[model samples]
Target chain A: MLAHYGYKDGSGDYFIIIDTDKCDGCGKCVEACAYGVMELIEDEFDIEDGSMAAVTEEHRKKIKYSCGPCKPISGERKLPCVLACSPKAISHSW
Target chain B: MITAGVDVGAKYVKVVLLEDGRKVLKRANGIVGFDILKSATEVFEKALLEAGLNHDRISRVTATGMGRKAIHKKHPLNAGEIVPEVIADAKGAYHLLPAVKTIIDVGAEEGRGVKVGEGGKVKDFVINERCAAGAGTFIETMARALEVGVEDMGPLALKATKAIPMNAQCCVFAESEVVTLIHSKVTKEDISKAIHDAMAGRIASMVLRIGVEKEVVLIGGVARNPGFLPPLKKELNTEITIPEHPQYVGAFGASLLAFETEGK
Candidate 1:
């Protein structure tokens, strides 16, 4: 399942895409995110499988501004949270 | 040397003028409106006027906050540099309380937990800008719904006779919850306490992530609310320091930085 975090506004679509199927919920992203943008929660899709990493509920509405500091203004730089995810489950749609 | 710092916050613009980076000569705050540039300039000029100084007297000016970029762009000649709000807050709080190792600043649109290292450098930090529920906006909205003055929320909440939990995680949902509580005949005091407690819970979670150290200082305009303070202290299980003119801490720090940069 592609668990998407963020919203579309008049400016553009800002999303923190996480592939729940690949996320092992190791919580490395949570530790790497200095802005409290991500958190680990019980996997609702895979209830019996324990937990998974997801973008925090509060951060879903304003991902562009919330993730602004970490995101490069121009060139593509690997985000700390995405890099911390060993399973390569994280991506950003800016 | 006289230096100035301007903090263009989401809801307000704060300016602090310092003499030789040690003593605050004047400070002014103005509500931010449609024109952030105007408001920033207004507050900065006001501070300078109050200090009986002119623009020529200011050796340097540093700007910080959400609208800092705008200030920097508009007055590139006047605004010497721009600093991050978190860094400004940490610097300001550490200046007031030298022993402070942690800073928890709750502003109109954001809440931040900053862990400070020696020399007031930021070691690590966490910000909650994405949620209105954990910020001052939540309290302002709930206070309006309850028909209580914002300044009176703290004292009224102190009289809360019951502990009513506020479960709504979003501000929009929380507003509806407040309406329901009002309809259910719940006392406004209890509702206010519940709202503050909810915000405290969120702030505590962020602070915990940063690992609170001793001498925790709370800054920002929200630090003035007495209702939020007790619950926040209780949630963190530690004493908190609130400096005089808590809201201007960021600007004060920026002024100090201006002085330092000028000296360098």
Candidate 2:
């Protein structure tokens, strides 16, 4: 299951997309996220039945502001949460 | 040339007037209530008046903080540009202490840790996630609960006899925990220290992400708290530097940017 969290604002669509299939729930992204945007939650459709990381509900509506500090207004994308995910399960829609 | 910077913080709006990009002519602070744009304008006009200057003397104006957009929207003619608070903080801190490599800023609604690179640029930064537990709002709430003045919490906390650990991770949960502490006869001093320590721990964790560097400067409203500083220093195992007017760093930095980017 691909979990998408975030909303489109006046700027554009800002989303943190996580591919649960590729995510092994190592919690690295949770640890790497400084804004506390992501948290470890129980994976409902997991074959192995383990926990996976997902964006916290409180930040869903304001991802643009919550994750604003990490995302530079200019320059290439190098998000810590995405980089910390070893399985490459995380991507940003900016 | 004279320039101005307006920082419309959640709790307070700060305005700084700078002359020739170096000397601070005047600074003003105003509480931000329902009208952020009005607060911003009031502070800016106050600063200019204090400096014995008029609006026409200001060559440029830069706005920052959460309410920067509103200031720009209303005063398009006055606010020439808007910059992020993180970049403004880094620039202001670096100007004060050139050796500052790490900057921790705790505001009313949020907290940020900025790692400064060469030329005082923000290399990397981290902001407190979703909760206000690690920010000044938590401390203010605890102070109100304890019936102590917010400004007095810092000095009173310094008188703690013993450390009491607050286990609540969320600000909402921490409020109940504080009430429980009060019922348990925990002294306000001890409770204050516990709150500062807990908030410091969260800030330390955020700073640890980019790694702590020497000459760490703590800015923003929380930096004024004496009790918070000791715990944050202890938590990070580092000596912290605080500028003269820590709360105005963002505005000061914005003013510096105004000086740099004017007419360009």
Candidate 3:
């Protein structure tokens, strides 16, 4: 858990991966982090309730810092942002 | 023993008159002209009167800042003909805050940093004259967003809640972002803190890159912004020294230069 908050790799080295199919394109990812690493992009994701929702201009996909990538998110220890995400649009690399 | 330094910055002209390292008087105004020399001379004369001195009593006059070259033409001092504005600021800060190793100066359209050695010499420095984010405009835009005067920002920001991240890299986009955040009901403190955080992060990165030393000092007009100091200090993990008159350091540096030259 401690490692989760602190970046593992050298500063400016870690990268964040997003699953577009699973991503609902909400901005919780960007809000959870203080570094302004992620941004909301426009994309679509199918929900579990057998409904297809499209992310319009009202919605956005989250991208990382412009200068570099975000930390690597994995299964056992998913991205902190993904865990804090309320819209359930994100998951770690399994 | 009486000397004067004039700094005609992009947004304001500063005049600092010193007597043997003791500051006699200082004045600043937001004035510009096609003939930067005339504008500087006029401001200098006004400052002289304020200090109970005359042009003839000023043994040497040194010029520093973007308008320094133009100001130099008005004064007939060969040794004081050309000097970088940042260098003059470093010299002034070295006199007032002798232990200061890192100096940050935020002007209207630019920001400057100086890393000085123990012997009052510049070790290294960085400048950001090209970006509005590094200057006072960042807070000015925030002031517009909050519907408050720029002078009120310091106290107003202290009342804000959690900081809402302001992600825009440029000033225009950042303003747009603040408007959106405001519309979303983000508290003013959060927005203000976010703005300060973003700029502080930028400054921290630069300061770290430059290898900052202990006893850092923040100067320039924006240094008056109350909320900027706490966040900047926290982010940099350093104590910052700011004078009662932070905005006059450049002119003070310029004045100190004049005094040094006159003594020689």
Candidate 4:
């Protein structure tokens, strides 16, 4: 399942899409996130039947605001969360 | 074989019975109070009695909803599998309307927007977490402020003549705003419309984040509200379909799954 966190308003769609199928529940993304945006959760949707990385409920509500500093609009930099995930399951829709 | 789906929702418990895995047999629901199991058993019993069957005859049971995990295994409501609400909702809507690709479920506590793929697969989904403004409770709370019954709010809102802006995005602040409107002599009808408008706006925004698709279906208890449809239709700019007994769609979907997965 593609779980979209965050919302869309007058500006545009600001969401963090987490593909649970590709995510392996590794804690790498959890530690790499400076804002504590990601966490390992037991994903019931995954066919593999194991935990996976998901955006915390707190960050999901205000994702654009919580991830404001690291947004690509500011400057080009390696996003620690995305970079740490070897499975490449995370992507941002701006 | 007969299968049952138990949807233990926050405000109510819904049960759906299916015969030979595909045909709808009976659907029953009731207000859920302090005892979750008791409420579930009563509703389940009502459905069985209506079908002229006994509890032991059910071959399998699948459960879903906010309170699904809370059900004990020793109880009669014990389900072989506990599926999440989104998957159950998507499956249920798609089964009822195979063409439906987008499903919006607005219950008492939360609202969800699900994007479905072929074969009732869940492609993408969004949930309004920890917020009352996007759910049916928003209307229920506003009804209290206007001294109207929950059922009356919808009809009252249709009588609104002017568009009133309610700026509060949170439920707590919205209540105070409703009180202020009342003190200012604003009619209850207009205030009710504003409440529905605000709620539809929030639900629409969440859905847009994932994108809306054609053949949209609206399920859950709030779909029964007469006032919520107009504003929601205007916001998403698309016609929405509501399945028969929309509140039981989730449970119905689970029953379908129980039948399909019988031998697995």
TM-score against native, each model: 0.76, 0.75, 0.72, 0.75
* Candidate 3 vs 4: which has more DockQ: 3
Q: Worst lDDT window (10 residues) for model 2 chain B?
A: B71-80
Give the per-residue lDDT of model 4 (tens digit) for B1-264: 999999999899999999987788899999888988788888999999999999899988888989887674637677888899999998899888999999999999989889899999998887876667778999999998889999999999999998998877668889999999999989999999999998987787677656777999999999999899999999899999988899999999999888888856
Each model's chain A TM-score: 0.91, 0.87, 0.39, 0.86
Of 2 and 3, the candidate ahead on DockQ is 2
Residue B6 in model 3: lDDT: 75
Q: Which candidate, 2 or 4, has the higher DockQ? A: 2
Candidate 4 Cα misplacement greater than 4 A, ranges: A1-94
TM-score of 3: 0.72
DockQ values of all predictions: 0.07, 0.07, 0.04, 0.03
- Candidate 2's displacement at residue B162, Å, is 0.7
Model 2, residue A45: what's the lDDT?
69
Best by lDDT: 1
Can you give the lDDT of residue A15 in candidate 1?
91
lDDT of 3 by residue, B1-264 (tens): 777777778877877777886856556554768777777767777787777776677777777778777756555332254578678878878888889888888777777778888766887776765667767887887789778788877777777778666667568878889889889988777787788887876665555545567788988888888878887898778889888688788888877777776677
lDDT tens per residue, model 2, B1-264? 988889988889999999889999998999997977877888788887788887898999999998898888466336978999999999999999999999999999888989999889999987764467768999998888888999999998899999988877667778899999999999988999998988888788767767789999999999999999999989889999999999999999999999999846
**If both were scored by TM-score, which would come out higher, candidate 2 or candidate 3?**
2
In candidate 3, which residue ranges exceed 4 Å CA deviation?
A1-94, B26-30, B33-35, B75-79
